[model samples]
Target: MGKRKRNERIGALIKILSHQPNTVFTLNYFSEAFEAAKSSISEDIVIAKKMLEELHLGTIETIAGAAGGVKYVPLVTPERAGFFLEKVCKKLEDPQRIMPGGFIYMTDIISSPSMVETMGEILASQFLNQEIDYVITMETKGIPIALMTAKALNVPLVIVRKNSKVTEGSTVSINYLSGSSNRIQTMSLSRRALKEGAKVLIVDDFMKAGGTAKGMMDLINEFKGEVQGIGVLIATREPEDKVVEHYTPLLYLEEVDVKNRRIIIAPNPKITTKI
Candidate 1:
């Protein structure tokens, strides 16, 4: 086959890298695919990496040694992350978003594919350098963000159901106090959902008191899996004593006034500090 042009090779390389986020590929793979030399491919990768960094598109990481290769890691800078979340904050400020219990209605934003994808990229980037085996989240609302995060990390997504289902086969269940309601609630997971000794990153759409997140950590422990990290798309600022100590929340619900129909939200400081 005729030698491919430098532009053609770079475009193809970017496409391949973007499609397989957090997956490593050897230089030989690209060289052989494009019928080019290793050195030439290396130069192409350098150029591609520079462009990606300059544009704040993403990052390309190189691992050394014969067993290692280069991988693409998705990133959303603090400035961009803050800007995007600010837009969501504005949308949520509307009085119509206020619910009966002082909860802001965020179903529409959480369900939006574009919004979830962006937040997922930001959340997943935090755990990319770690040994993450699976992405776990409670079923329903959290599923979308968790699924997207798992996609970015190239890992499996596990759902912890609110109610046990016969279709899931044998399952493990646990009871935990509801942080917001001050009541008991039950959550369950399939016995086969995660393998023993796996490291899991928990994702959730909203966290009020973090009782549910704490329960998820307990469930992982029961299965002999390690809790690698916890992430919430949005969390309440009040009731600061979260049962789960460590977590990265994209946005924080600072204040909500039902009578005035007012809501205050901002990017979580953890997003800037951690990511």
Candidate 2:
């Protein structure tokens, strides 16, 4: 093929791989679709992979064998991730962010599409190798972040609603005590939403005592789904005994002194949550 034609083919390949991160596409599939030699397709992938890495866009992996091919994995570099988390912490420090009932007002940040997308990319990279079947989150505040994570992982997003909805058809509902409030609440999920024995990743905006995360684990069990991993945007400090033991929180709310209007937050040391 001509130089221009080859370039067009390479550009199109990148688009396909990027759009379907974590999904492997057999080299034969690309060669057949492009009507080009396998060798040419391999060369194009090499170029695309290099460009993606240099730009910090993402990385591509080449799988071998009959079922092997290439797959893209989205990621946010440690430096960029640290910068974004610090900025978020600074925003949280605003005294106005302190709301009634000792809660931090974070509706604006979690709802921001751009911010949530970046958070999702960072968190998704952590679970890329887990082989998750779906990204699960609660119906309300966690949906935006979860949706973006699902997009990056190329998986379906499943929502656990606070109550059973008539539009969801038959549902599996469970009642659990709220870890933070000690109040009993109900959470429901559509029975048809997930496949039996599927692996699910749980994502949430905030975690306090992990009542909701534990509840999610129970809900997933109803569908015979396994909880592969869990991720949270922020975790409160007082709840030292969180029901869910394993989770990667981007930031920890170490201290929230309502009287002094002081809020101390720190990044997760295990991961590059902050600088």
Candidate 3:
């Protein structure tokens, strides 16, 4: 191929870095791809990083040494995160989302590819410096966001299942009380799923009393793993004291008044205050 133009090289560099967030790509690799010198590739990286930072999209970071390379970090700025979260709060506040038992129906929101992708980016940003080895979440509802978080962090996702499946091979199961229903429930994980002493970040869709989150923590402990952080999409305001104390929730569900047919929710102040 002929020598690529500077604009072409930068555009392609940004595209490649953005698509594989947190994964290092050596400057020499780009040098060969663009048929340019390492110095030219380094310059392209600088331009791409500046553009991303200026636009609040994300940033490109260059690592030094033999193992070092340029990688993209999907760090969401407080302003952009606040705006996106507030939009989600409005969507969730619709009375039509209220269910029979005062639960909010948010299938559409969490299932949206774009919304969940951004949510994942925001959640991943919270623990960017934690050096997370895996992203863990309970199966089913939380899988989408958890998977996306794992993608943003460029780590593997470990799912704790509600029940043991025959296909899971040898499994470790534990019983824990459900915070919402106040019933004893069983959660399981494959013995081989997690590595001993691995640092993990837990991501979930919702938290009422953090029973599920606590259960996950216990399971991680069984594998001798460390819990770096916990992130949830929404948490109830009434249960001020949750089973898991140190958790970051994107939105607070203040009330779901079934009789009044009103839902009051907003972005977490901790998140909005930073903006």
Candidate 4:
């Protein structure tokens, strides 16, 4: 291949780094790929890093030592997070979303690719420094955001099933009280899903009383994994206290009045103010 121009090199560098967030690409590797000198690649990295940081897209980091390389860390600025979350709150406030049982329908929001990808980036940013080994979530609803979080962190995603699957081989099951329904529920995980002492972040679609989040925590404990953090798309304000404490919720669902066809929700003050 012929020598690549500066702008061309920088563009390609950003594309590769951002595509695999948190994955390190060696300078030598770029040098070989672009048919450029290590010095030229290093300069390209500096330019890419500056542009990304200035635009609040993400950050490119250089690692030192033999194992070190350049990596991209996808981060959402607090301002950006607050703005996006506020928009979601507005969408959720539509009274039409209220269900018969006083629940707000949010399947479309959580399942949206663009929305969840942004949500995942925000959640992943909060725990980026924690060196998370995996992102965990319950089956079905939470999978999309959790998978995106895992993708942003460049880590694996562990899904806890409502029941053990024979295909998963031996399993570890746990029973916990459901905070929302006030009933005992069972959740199981594949024995080989997580390694002992792994650090994990729990991502969920919603938290009413945190019953499901707590259940996931208990399931994590079964494997001796540490719960570094918990993130949920929305949490109920009435609960005040939850089965699991110390969680980050992007939005607070204050009320869902079925009879009046009213829904009240807002971005978490903690998130907006912190930004």
Question: Regarding TM-score, does 2 or 4 come out ahead?
Answer: 4
Worst 10 residues of 1 by lDDT: 266-275
Residues 187-255 of candidate 1 have per-residue lDDT tens digits of 999999999999999999999899989999999999999999998898888789888888888888889
Which of candidates 3 and 4 reaches a greater TM-score? 3
Q: Which ranges in model 4 have alpha carbons more than 4 Å from their true place?
A: none
Against the unseen true structure, what C-alpha lDDT does each candidate score? 0.89, 0.89, 0.92, 0.89
lDDT string for model 4 (202-232, tens) is 9998888888988888888888899999998
- Measured on C-alpha atoms, candidate 3 has an lDDT of 0.92
Candidate 4, position 137, lDDT = 95
Best-performing candidate as measured by lDDT? 3
Best by TM-score: 3
**TM-score list, all predictions:** 0.94, 0.91, 0.98, 0.96
Clashes of each: 0, 0, 0, 0
The alpha-carbon lDDT assigned to residue 46 of candidate 4 equals: 89
Cα error, candidate 1, residue 2 (Å): 7.0
Pairs with steric clashes in candidate 1? none
Model 2, 137: alpha-carbon shift in Å? 0.9
How big is the positional error of residue 23 in model 4, measured in Å on the Cα after superposition?
0.4
